[model samples]
Target: MQSNRGTPLTPSQAASPHAAAVADSSVTRSASQQALILAGVCIAVLVLPLNFGGAAVSAPTIGTALRGSPVAINWILNAFMLSFGSSLMVAGALADLLGRKRVFAVGVALFAATSLGISAAPSLVWVDFLRALQGIAAALVLAGSSAALAQEFDGHGRARAFSMLGTTFGVGLALGPLLAGFLTQTFGWRSFFLADAAIGLTGFALGVPKLRESYDPHANGLDWPGAISFTAALTLFTFGLLQGPESGWSSPLIVALFVGAAVMAIAFVWIEGRVTRPMLDLSLFRYPRFVGVQVLPLATAFCYVTLLLVLPTRFIGIEGHTAIGAGLMMVSLSAPMLFVPLTAAHLTRWMSAGVISAIGLVIAAIGMLWFSGIGFDASATVLAIPLFVIGVGAGLPWGLMDGLSVSVVPKERAGMATGIFSTTRVAGEGMTLAVASAILAVLTRLRLADALPGSPDASAHAVTEAAQRVATGDLAHAAAFLPALGQPVLVHAYDGAFRVLLHMLVAITLASAIMVLGFLGRTPSPTSRDPASPTLS
Candidate 1:
């Protein structure tokens, strides 16, 4: 038999079922090379938001272009996250049960098609719908690619593969805003989605001829019930969280959504326990190291998303910087990500995964502490130091954590484990954004009351808007407030926001550090599997 790359099966391999099976099912060298290439192609899908985040200074223009209402504009950005977070586990399991190569190819095709649809969308509703579809494609690619790489490589080779994947993912995420800012500034928001479609199509054309499928012949059935329940729980929970502030948190609808989400989540656990083929094996938590690996990523994700949300608001709104300036400031957040994966791989040679993770969390906490001290008057250069420190801490843990997660699980279960890990990380990222926004809102209102002498309600509204504008540094609007309340009120509000953001970071990071160090014992060698490993199967 010949592989997709036209490599002939060797005679000795043909003589043995296992060898033939491995050769037939395993990735070709060309396929492995293409895996990294495909990963880059898939990353283009994320560029839309990165561009939008910085360019949303022109949200009114974007809204007009898409013919969307204000609420629709928000959905255009959030729909992707909602679908991406909800579908990740199902995509991973499907890829494992079916074939990684096949699912990835399908995802690429779907993503390309949806990107084009978004480009041509006549209304915001259609654009949002297409974006949701694009998220499903992204989920499939992300979940399948990681699992495929895990199956294709072992030992040092696996570490390098993961490092490369993590590095590419980080780079894509960082570059998205930069590219988006430039493109939106020059071309328009439509260019972002168009470029993504073009890139996805190009990658698919180059990869389809060479990519290989990786799936265990002995893999269990897909956990439809688990996938459905998990998706429902996440969707309802995220919706409630996002809507809580706008719709009163005390609203009956909000209350029902939260309760429904909680009930579904409990039911998901019960269903997973009884199912022979669980989407996420509950038993993975049994091993302290495995639990630590999972928790560490969640922590890192929380910090990363929180920073992404808060920093731009602080830099552009409060400091009177331009959109470009705000995007550039994130260089501190993103530049370190490029080098961290390689650095993490190197560190893994000297230290255990647990120690590396713990150290990273501690450093991140310190960075958060330093960031808390930043006032309205702080210089851009001064801010970069702590931002870069947090980036470094964020970068160091992922490669090691991913390597450790797969190392402990049997090869056959790699897809399921990888899927679950991705789901948690994505959920953490989304949840953190919502949580951080709520915190900032509350603090802004409180600070306004303390800073102003007018009617508390009037002052709170004015201060909240001023604080938001200051956080984004929309100097034109923020400057208007300086005359009414003067710089002192703006300064006080900004200080209050920074303090609250810092506290949140410190609390989350400290809690994560404690969880890792206390729960995750010394890392065992890759070959050792705790007989007491906590897996649902």
Candidate 2:
């Protein structure tokens, strides 16, 4: 029997078979729509991180046209990373207080606009400024998108959602170089940014309307003091490391910057603890599982992100591979990410997320160590094997780490947890890039001093120019600036510096693996179905 609009009916009367079927169909449609909305979010994420890999491949050309110094060129990448990492927690907090959909829409619009600004930039300074703005835009999008997904899905569904996101991220990073190569080689580096702007606008048009708003009711207060301290600490810390190689490490200014960074870091912790609502939840770190999930991303970023930039640069500068060609070479590093993330759930059934991540790190360390042994004379075929192994290692832990991070947190705090995870990863990348560049610079100087015997001042000046050119990934061009006698030495020096850098990465990755294993405790045997916890399914 049909119920009148104002009348209540018993269960059997209320749910006739036809009515039940109709209700089920309606639910199916809603679920489909929700999945489509998640797809849009993934599309945006996939396109965003592309900027780094694409820019890394094309940076030499940009540096050459702009006549930028090595430091300025590195800053092109560092500036965006630094601002993104610093602003992530604040953006997350804002999303949880305001509206996620509103913040996300704003982020998409801002990203599109700033990308255009970057494309039209007249100098490195303009580019850096616009890139920094884009980073903030990206932070807003990341926090909003991930929080929305976490709220909508749970258990296996949430894991699937995160895996899809990770897969798209991998696809974007993998294809970025290829796109950058095609655009930059055909038109110019500016074309890459223009492409990004167009993609951002398109993503905004499709995504914003379908996204539902989600926020934490209890999450109040902006926590400006904590935000300021955190940002200042990372900025100052990165500044010191970046400057240390150029100016003496013990220089008064560098020392002061380091000291200021330390002070700000302590202040951030103090402010967060006392605040009514903290930007970072200090209590999350006390949970070993949460700590493990967070630390894995850092280790992944430290071990893998540098290779994304460094390898393309190496190929272009030393081997004279076209930008596109270098990007193709990176397929060995990016392609495995595609398959592994999609099947991460299957792997987790056999081992804990921590065990899988540690194993992946160990594999990556082996790949880096293998690459370290191959000198400049090695063929691309020789390089491909190690690069392939590294790609596999990186892929194994990709989505699993992201899922585990939020799985351990309450749904309400997903934005905050994601913010912390993204912050740690990018922050690690920024600091590691700075240190790696410093190592490259110092090594270049030492090598040049031995090779070019003359007035100390003259040799020092030559070393600086050569290092700048090398940093641009234009080694063949660098030869034009160096004396014929020193050209070989410069090439060999760049090679040696890269080897040492890889070794350093290997050491860091191994250390991270050990920590992960220690914190992970034990996993259920393959035959056992572990009971679902509130944090993890």
Q: After superposing candidate 2, which stretches have Cα over 4 Å from the reference?
A: 1-36, 150-161, 406-418, 454-458, 474-485, 521-537
Best by lDDT: 2
lDDT of each: 0.60, 0.69
lDDT of 2 by residue, 253-286 (tens): 9999999999999999999889766767677687
Candidate 1 regions off by >4 Å?
1-77, 120-127, 147-163, 213-221, 408-415, 449-495, 525-537
The alpha-carbon deviation from the true structure for residue 70 of candidate 1, after best TM-score superposition, in angstroms, is 7.3
Error of 1 at 6 (Å): 22
Q: What is the lDDT of residue 292 in candidate 1?
A: 70
- Clash count for candidate 2 is 1
